[model samples]
Target: MAIAEALLAASPQSACTAMIDFSGRVSKNPKLDIRAPGKLSLSHLLGWQGYRMLALLLSDVLALKMAWQIAAHFNQFYSPLPPELNWGSWLRLPSLFWLFAAATLLFFAYGGLYSSATQWKNYLRAGKLVSMVYLLSLVMGYFYDPKLDPPRSLFFTAWFGSVVLVIGFRLLTTLILRQFEQSQSPIPVFLIAPGDRLATLSHLLEQQLNFKGQSASHYQVVGAALATTAHTPTTVQTILASKAKEVLVENLPDTALASALYWQLRRHGITLRLLPSSVDMLHRRGLPEIFAGLPTLRVEPRFLSSLEYGLKRSIDVFGALVGVILLSPLFVAVAIASRLSSPGPIFFRQERMGLHGKVFHMWKFRTMVTEAEALQAQLEACNEIKGGVMFKIRHDPRITRFGRFLRSTSIDELPQLFNVLLGQMSLVGPRPLPLRDVERFDTWHHIRHQVLPGITGLWQVSGRSDIADFGDAVRLDLYYIDNWSLNLDLDILVETCRIVLFGKGAY
Candidate 1:
């Protein structure tokens, strides 16, 4: 655990240098000063660090072998090309394909698609890079041989399949490696919180870090750190003495003890992590730097780059188009039912906060009566949820007969396909809140607006209307923002289907 923390503390480039330095000393030279800070060159090329280098090499070799095998299979299955065509005429393709594959692999690596830094970042980059490689391969095929060019259909199949296969291969490797590491050298984590808060933090970490609800074999709570100064020093001393790798302080109040304990842990080479707390650590200043070049604190925000944003928008457009086409029958049925059930419009367009806190008219099929808003004030005292956010009663009297059905099945949200097509929402992202909700938000809540709102999101699939507390909702939203990715989005979409079909956690 200490080794992992030390490695994590080092920059990616430094970590690569350290690995190279260690490797060189053991294999080639003995007197190299690999430990000297900032001495190593090739920092940019450090993406080829440690086992990732081996993974890339293996991926290239496998891609080449697969390409050749595919070419052989194609030659066997398809009629022979004109007499002018020969094996030699297409030999350049496999070579060029391998070269492009290697370049794409490196591109993905450099983009942090292969790093532990962020999960969603990795997934997004993988999709875009793989897609780009597919397009490039198609263009390369066109240039290679116009007369004996492979069928466009075959090219598309091979290109998409190859990208999928390559990405799957890498993902499998990563999963296997992670599982092995978890089994062999479980992370040594220490929990520091008031005794009352210990169980909650412990359960959360165990569930997240150690799958299967098993107690984390890698993590151990040395002791609890009180928010009060009277016991803070004693807790810190006890924790340091235990030699725990990482100290996680939970539910710490914004107070002097919190600041003192943080600096104390720093002095002893112990990494401090704060759990989900009401106090805004973002406002704290004067953080003490332990390492020479490292920042004392790190804050990660959730937002994709311009390229990733564009790619995501492209996906949304394509998905929304296909979805609307396929579900046109359902859409028509819902619209007719809604009109028959209620005298209001088929669709509900309400002002919701979107990306960057911009106001947009979010679309949904109306699942309430035309005068639903007018009745909100009268029903305020009957609210079931504790949060300041507005939530309707499970047996709301204002809901039309068809509206109840729509709410239960979540079919009312289907019209958001139009919003997605119009670039107002994504197929999967943080749920867009109303402008009134945004006005009530604190600083941390603002993070949700960093990305475009989604038709279905973490909150919807995780619990939907069942999640009554605003704090839980915010945490889930923050978790999604912190860990967004194409794979995660796909997972949420699948889960959303299950939730909708089963009517789980629906109003």
Candidate 2:
């Protein structure tokens, strides 16, 4: 309660002004305010609020139940104790047993176990809590009633059983709530942003926030304050006319404007939030924090940590090794075909820019004529794609007969396994572009090099050559960088298989 109060108090009222560069056209009329989505009574809120209480009650009951069951199992297995030395006997001493159970619950609650706001949060907190409770119970038993406590060998079994029971109860509850939400009530949301920012916010909300019966039904755009360049009113009334339950401001460069916006929204009894900046959006950073007595918002970057990188590398090496072994026959066959069909080396080696702009030799099975690079300039007029980076004809005349089959099957990229094993590439990540392509990239495009390049990535699986827009390509790469996770990588791998089998977007 104290923490929640402190957090609420730390957030201050802010005033905001929305400005538009409308081709320097000045209008005497005020900009119209539009309403989008507002808060709604969500069914999930009921489940979220009551889950902690239910979890605690369930944990206590399950722990006791498991304790008794384990005690019975121990008596059956190691029968130095009589059959009567079970839960029934323990229940006769109800005062002692209940006291221990109460202590366990208290210990769990104190360890920040029952304060979770989400299902994953609950499970993680519960696991920690149950472990703490088990340790406390063991300590208390060792000190107070060693003789009554079960054998040390059974301690782990009892602890394991209790954890399963607690986790099982939470999972079951989550399943029930999910099913109910899927069948019935809609999730409610309020969207607040400037007119220009509303479209992007709406797209995001539709993708992430629209749930079941509730969609973003209301959107409110706060109009600019009526004032000259110098001395604008920084109060809530000057900006917002209608009462907003939540306020979301687009990323404003002026701290004064941002602070003013926050103040005005809060003054109108609204919960203030800021639309993530382009940097934040690209990095996928979560909510900003409100520090005590500070008007400034501090947002933490949500990039993959070093530990995550290490885990990804481990998976890469393991997967690459397996792939190399499993696909060696295909590799041999492609090598023979390339050598027979082309007059050059079986493998085409080219320098490509990798992580941190480092240059490395990338290998691919020869998929074009020996003079394909020389023919690129002549074929420029025939190029179908429009971009600074080079993309040849999909059915380029320079490609060898067998090269077409190799390119379609993605067998041409097999030599990249050597690059993966060399720590120059990953099994999944942004594609490493040639140095020529990297040189042509603008400042924002350099972000793809922040991580090691991959053999198959978001681009390859997300339509590859089919996507003609360079901006979309860069966005996909940025999305992969920002949202990189083991599970996401696995999903990409699965998608890659489907893409390969169908050769959907291959040239």
Number of the top candidate by TM-score?
2
Model 1, 144-166: lDDT tens digits are: 77655655444554555566656
The lDDT values for all models are: 0.58, 0.57
Q: Candidate 1, which ten residues in sequence have the lowest lDDT sum?
A: 30-39
The lowest-lDDT stretch of 10 consecutive residues in candidate 2 is: 29-38
RMSD of each: 16.5, 16.0
lDDT of 1 at 209: 41
TM-score of each: 0.50, 0.51
Error of 1 at 359 (Å): 0.5
lDDT of 1: 0.58
